[model samples]
Target: MISRRLRETAVAGPFLSVKGLVFGLFILVPFVYTFILTFQRGSLLTGMRWGGLSNYRTVVTDTLFRDALKNTLLFMLVCTPVTLVVSAAVGLLLSSSLRGMAVHRALIYLPSLLSVVATGLIWKVLLDPEQGPLHLLMLRGFGLDVPWLTNGTVAIVLLAFITAWSTCGFYGLVFMAAFNGIDTELLEAARIDGAGPWQVLVQIKLPLIQPVAQVVLALLTINCVQVFDLVFVLTNGAPGTATYTAMWYVYQNAFNGGSVAYAATMSVMLLILTALISALFLARRTGADADA
Candidate 1:
């Protein structure tokens, strides 16, 4: 038994060592370097000098950063709950064993398979105020000229909806798996005990799927907070920076504004925010599980 165990260890040890080395080189090292960079002032072209927390102070005082932070928080507030609820509802609906359900599921998930840039470009075209199909239809058919991307409020709302549309399929898949994992016997018992569909969903299925919901919520929150690519392609933080997000601000500072250290500071702040949100969700989940 000892000899066999040693043989297994020998086979696995090298692979595990290589994996750890790769992880450290790619993820761990870059993360530490980024954190360190946040304390320095200078672009990549210009030599860096230690600035301590001055970069962070600059971020706190910058109006652009403040706008970005506010917009990011707004996006999370609007997008997260809508995404979760819609995904869960769609997942529950699609979980039914109906004919052509597989086709429906595929259709729903197809959007998620598209690249972020592709998704954003598609929505950009669709929502174009002048020549886009939806815009033209509204204008020609109903005599309404709704500026989807030009109006600040409309632009933000449209971005949130498009984001939700793009991501809901993936979350739907997660919820579907959670729903399928639910014991059918318990559902049957609830039905036999005179539970309606609404009651079963609200009182049983939701409670049972709390852990999955928590995970989805955390992921969605992080994604919403870090949103950049889609916004970059779709609106480019247009209409006077109304739609500018925190990640967009980071990118702008690093690449466009030539404030790499300030960008690093913003990045670190975002990372801290994401970690805190995730930790809160995890704590709630732990408490709920303990109570159960």
Candidate 2:
């Protein structure tokens, strides 16, 4: 029985699907190409040449890249937690058995269905100081012309929360499913024993769902690190380069600046950071399971 179970868990034979192999091949090809390019220096006009680790050296000394990395890190730090908390709140709200919740949940989830471009444009219009509904409302109601996207700190925070609002619907649905999986009997017993909603949630439901929470956190971290499109549409790293995320920097260097190889080096570094964070989460999860 143990051997059969071990075989089931093994990485060879039945564990590798044909479609998965094809998908992995597609992923692997780009990874290899990126790493190979990282070692060479070239441009659309200059063509490719073997430049060795000069790009790596450039990455080490590039102040702009440093600022971009810092911004990306800050965005991830703010966005990931905000996403998780907002997702959890949405999940908890939707997991209830109350009537009309399907419609409400769908309404809440509608943002995730829209393309990033569409949502970003929607936000752009809404944030416009003169015409944006939100801005106009703030002005009319409070007599203040709120700098919706002009200020640096406000822009980053707004970008983070807006991204969170857009993406949380799907993760929120994940949490909803997690919540739905909790045994009602335990909840009833907890209530009978005088545990309040917050206490039961804190002591029982959350602990039971730690595995799901870890997965959500890891995925959110990875997504936050690669964020670019919304930044492109919204700020374009404007108002003094305040929102230049890692991937945005990579894009700017690759296409706009025509330093594909140098950009690939940064891309590789971003990939490493993602891998390390993912491994950390997996390792922590494994250790917790072992302690259990």
- Cα deviation at 15, candidate 2, in Å, is 14
Candidate 1 Cα misplacement greater than 4 A, ranges: 1-6
Worst 10 residues of 2 by lDDT: 11-20
Quote each prediction's TM-score. 0.96, 0.90
TM-score of 2: 0.90
Off by over 4 Å in 2: 1-21
Give the alpha carbon lDDT tens digit for every residue of 1-292 in model 1. 9999999999999999999999999999999999999999877886899988898888778998888888888888888889999999888978889899999999999999999999988877877776789888999999988988787677777788888998899999989999999999999999999999999999999999989999999999999989999788988899889889999988988889668888888999999999999999999999998998
- lDDT for model 1, please: 0.89
**What does candidate 2's lDDT look like per residue over 1-292, in tens digits?**
9998887768565556776788778987888988999989878587899999999999999998999888877888899999999899889999998899999899999999999999999999998876889998889999988776788778888888988999999999999999999999999999999999999999999998888899999999999889998899999998888888889989988889659899899999989999999999999999889988
What is the lDDT for 218 in model 2?
Answer: 99
How displaced is residue 111 in candidate 1, in Å? Answer: 0.4
